[model samples]
Target: MAPSSQSSLAAKPLSEFSFPSPEVTASPYPFYEAMRAEAPVYKYPDRNDYLLARREDILFVFQHPEIFSNLTYLADPAQAGRVLASKPPGSVLLTNSVLSQSDPPEHAVKRRALRGLINPRYIHSCEQSLRRIANELIDGFIHRGEVELRSEFADKLAVLTICELAGFPPEDRDIFLSWHRIGTGHGARFLTPEQRALQGKDGPEQQAYIEKTIAARVKEPRDDFITEVIQDQIARDGELNLPYLTGTLRQILTAGNETTSRLLTTVMKLLIEHPDQLAKVVANRDLVPGAIDEALRFEAPTQWTSRLVMADTEIGGVQIPKGAFVFMLYGSANRDETWTDPDRFDIERPAVRELNMAFGGGIHRCLGSPIALAEGRLGLEIMLDRLKNPRFAPGCEDERENIDNFQKRVPKALHILFDAQ
Candidate 1:
C-alpha cells in the first residue's frame, strides 16, 4: 500500500515555509512530502506565486499551457526589465525569441529553427565525438589517482562538447563555462549582493561575445549549428536578426552545458554511493543508459519551473486567481508516491512508464534533452572503462555541495578516487 500522507507535517502553515531556504534547498524531499500532503497548491506569503508539489497538479499544468502560460517575459515584466537593464542597449535579452521564455507562434517558430540543429539524428551522430571528448577529459586526471569530478572532468567535457557543436573557438571553452556560472549565479535567489553584482558583469560580456560570433558566422558560415541558424535566417530573408540569434545562442550554450554537467556529476555521485549499482554498471557497460535515466529521475538537475496563470483556475481544491504564478516542483513530482519505490535509486526499475519529469513535458519540454542524455551515457561509459575501481576520495563521500537555488539542483563539487589504469 502507498504510505499514508505525512499528517505530522500538515500542521505547519504555508506562510512559515520558505522555498529557497538553505535547509530546504539542500534537501527538499522532506519539505516536498509535507507540501504534497498538506498543501498541493501553496501560496507564498507576500508573493503572487503558488507552489504546486503534487504530481497530478504538475502534470495538469504541463498539459494545459493555454491556461498556464510559458510566456515568462510577458508574465513577469519587472523581472524581464531588470534582465534587459543588465544587457547592452537595444538588446532583447528577455524577448520572446528565446525558446524557454516564449509563447505560441513565436515559440513554435524559434523551436523549429533550433530543432533542425539539435535533432535526434544530429545528437546520435555526435556520440563518437562525445566519447572522444570524455576520454580526453579522463586522460587529464587518470594519472593523479584522485580528482574533483565536477571541475576536472564533467564541467570541461560538457562545455567543450557544446562549444564544438555551436561553432565557437576551442580556446573560448573556459570563457563560455565561466559565463554560464556567472549567469546562473546571478539569477539565483539565494546569492549575496556582492556575488550577484560580480556575476552581473558577465551578462553583457556574454552578449558581446555571442554578438561577435553571430556576425562572424553570418559572413563565414561553417558546418556547425550556428551556421545552420545563420543559413535559416538568410533563407527567411533575414527575419531573424542579431539580437534574436544571440538570445537563442545564449540559451543553447548555457542550458546545454549546465544541465548536462550537473547530470554527469550527480550520476557519478549516485553510482559511487551505491556500490551494488556501480558494480553492475561496471561489469556490463550496456546498463549505463538505464542508469542515466534513473539518475535523472532520482535527482533532477532543473528542479522547478514556473508558469503564469492566464485565467482563474482551481487546482487541488484551491482557487488560483488569474495572473498568479504557479511553480511546478519537478524534483518533488519525480519522487511522488505514484512510482514504485520512488525514492530508491534502482537502475533496474522498469522502464515501461514515464519514470520522471526531469525533461518536463508538453511543447516546452527541453530541446537539448537528446544531446544531454547522449553526452551523459557516453561520458559514464568512458569513465567506467578507464577508471579502475572508482570510489569517492577519503572523507569526501559526504562532501557533496548543491547550489542553493530553487530552480536548479546542481552539485558544486564531487571528489572521487580511483586506481590509475
Candidate 2:
C-alpha cells in the first residue's frame, strides 16, 4: 500500500512483484517497462493471486474461461465479506449482484436482462445526448483556463450521462455519487484501518437510498431504465426478484460512472500531455472514436480485474493450480510490447489491434462498452474544442501509475489556459 513502485522490483522477492506502487499506481507507465521485463505473471507475497502483466497473458486469461474464472472468485464468501465489511452492507447487491459477482447461468441471466435495457443500437442512439453533456461540461470550464479535470468535467459528465440514462434525478446526484465512491473504496490501498472502517457506512446507506428511490419509481414509473426494469420486464420470470433488479441497477450505476469517468479524465490529460495528438483530433473529429480507443490503450481506467481459478491451468510455462487467483493486470498489458508500441498514445492506432482487454473479453466483457466509447468521444471532442493552449501545469506532470490500478489519473489534474474566441 505504500503505493510507489519505483523501487518495488528491488524490494520484491526474486519471484514476486508488487502492484499499485504508490508511485506506479499513481502513474504506472514508467514502471510498466520494469513490470513487463521482470515479472509478467507476478507473484506477490502479500496478495492472494498471481498478477498477469503481459498483454498476451492478460488477454488470454480474460478470454479463456476454462483457464480463468470470475464467477466463483467474485462470490468467495471470504472475499465478499472482506470487501463488503470494508463498507456498510446496505444493498447486498454489491456482493450478491449477478453482473460483477456471479458466474455462468446467473451471470448470463442478469447480463442478458441488463443488455435488454440498452441494446447496442440503443446505446448508439444516445451519442447525441452524450455529446450534449460533454459540450456543456467543457463549455463551462474551457474559459476558466484551468479546471480540476476530475471533479469538474470527468466526474460530472460520467455521473450525469449515466444517471439520465438510468432515469435518476440530477437532484439525487449526491446520493448515487456517494454509493459509487464507497463501492470503489473497497480494498483501496490508500485507506487506513480507521478510514476503511469509516467507509463501512457506504453499504447500508446506499441500499436504503436506492431501494427507496427505486421502489418509488416502481409504483410511479417513468420513461427511464429503472422504470423499465421494475414495472415492465423485471417480472417476466417469477424469479426476477427485487435483489435482481437492484443488482442490475447497482452494476449500471457503478460501472457506467467509474469507467467512463476514468476514460474521460485520461483523454483530457493525454490531450494536454500530447498536444500534437490533440491537434490531430481537432483536425478530424471523426478521429474521436479512435482517440478514445488509443486513450483506453494508453491508460485504461479499470486497471486489474482478477479471476479465481476453479481448475488447474497452464500459461506461458506456468502451471496455476486449482483455487489460485489469476489477476489480469490490464495496466501492464496496455503497455506490453508483445502487443504494439505499447507506450505511444496514437489516435490513428490500428482498429483491429486496439488493446480491448480494457473492457474485458469473452462473456464478461463490459456490457456498457458501447456507451463508454460514445461518452469518451463526446467528452474529449468538447474538451478539445475549447482548449486554446493546453499544457500540463508546471511541475505537475503525471507523476506515477494512477491513484490506484483500478482508477486512473490523467495528467492527474489538467491546467489549461484557453484563449477567448
TM-score of structure candidate 2: 0.83
Span of ten consecutive residues with least summed lDDT in model 2 = 1-10
- What TM-scores do the predictions have? 0.90, 0.83
Query: Candidate 2 lDDT, tens digit per residue, 261-340?
Result: 87887777777678788888888889888888887877777766767787787767777778777767676666665454
In order, the Cα lDDT scores of the candidates are: 0.77, 0.65
- TM match of model 1 to true structure: 0.90
Residue 392 in model 2: lDDT = 59
Best candidate (score: TM-score): 1
Candidate 2: deviation at residue 220, Å?
Answer: 1.3
